[model samples]
Target: MARVVTKPDTLNQLNQDFEQQVLTVPVFLNSVPKCGTHLIRNIFRMFVPVNQQYHDTFIQIPVLRQHVGAFNYLQPKLSWGHLLFSDESAMALRKAQHLVVVRDPYDWVLARARFFLSDNFQGNLEHLKSGQINLEEILNMMIFGIHEKVPSLSDIYTHNAAAWLGTGTKLVRFEELKHHVQNLESDDAEQYFRELLSVLQLREFPTDWRERVRVGSDREQSGTYRDNLTNTAFTLPDQLPEQQRKLVDYAAPGLRNLLGYCD
Candidate 1:
């Protein structure tokens, strides 16, 4: 039997029933940088209907507020962003089903470094590209946020998971989701997606949509954090420059214990 490709319009028509689904408030998917923000966005794209307009980053959204007239009527909305939490953001999130994702900080930092080097990223790349700094110095700048007391691109890497998400946000580890989605061969794959759906209160995702999710795109280029350092000589401790190490120690206190990065 030939497989029929469903047109976007056809799929949108079929998904209209889900549009009217009851959600008491908007849905928010927020995360740490390099913590699978795109992964959740894909999930939302497949599961959420077209009529809904979800905000990816509340703060980044220009000139919008809690009582914005257009947003009030966009029922059952979903949003995702990489913004750090603040009192104002938290207050705005109170009315939404907010979720957060975190990864081992070491791994997050390493992946971010590679991503920073990519041509399309367009973030502050001069330091990473500079011939003067070794990988360790670059990692130090990223982890500690300063190289010689000047703020570096590594400033983005200083987020503490607990501090960023605060008290009310629900957290999921990046490894857990990556493991399940990337391993379709596993018998538990379906169960894992179901578990995610349940957690997010999204009851309408198409059952076979798992096969459509492009898990291949998620494969880590250098593999894990330690593997990312294979070409370089430094281990995790040696990765951070002396001053940067002190800054990291202060910035992410208890993060090592919290995220089980001890190994």
Candidate 2:
């Protein structure tokens, strides 16, 4: 099993600082593995009471059956995970308000490569961290994946994001989420969040929505945040290289378009 080393966040304690509402319906924040899972989860944490938030596990396919109660409509909780599209998952989320978060494939490749190379991630690919493989090779591995080891980008996106579309799951783009968080003072940001949080079915949007978002969106609280990653030997490019970007398109084909990242 792969392990991610993330520092404990104060959001649970900070959540007390706000007047939270009990969730009337279960809410699931599903996403492609590297597509700002914590960012969306953290923001929602501020609006929900601590006890109503599922802290049992990250809720993946393997242990989903055990945590099926996270989606219990009668005991509604705010849960998040990398659940793929399947009969089991579809049934599990049948009674919940589902939100799927995704990032542009071009950028997802970079994020995956960076996380795998960082000391914070300990998994089978730890061998790649020895600098034996060049950055390009690592990036390629992220796209096509290591044979029989990591799953390819297309496989991950197809099941995790694409297939879930048109299934009534609301799509939330990482870029748009981050943009609104960064510009909370603007009317556009206000409207953006109102729409985003609409799935939660809060009786009324809180007056201090901006402050809650600011606290929840803090990069320092995110262990997987790019700058927060530790002992990263290589300096990753701010944008994907043209060659690698083309490789993403080739590997995933219509992925970016399916996720509304491209025309």
Clash pairs of candidate 2?
A: none
Estimate, for each residue in 153-174, the C-alpha lDDT of model 1 and write its tens digit: 3344333246654576677787
Best by the lDDT measure: 2
Reference-based lDDT, each prediction: 0.54, 0.93
| Cα-based TM-score, every candidate | 0.67, 0.98
User: Among all windows of ten consecutive residues in candidate 1, which has the lowest summed lDDT?
Assistant: 1-10
Best by TM-score: 2
Query: Local error of candidate 1 at 62, Å?
Result: 8.1
Summed backbone clashes in each candidate are 2, 0
TM-score of 2: 0.98
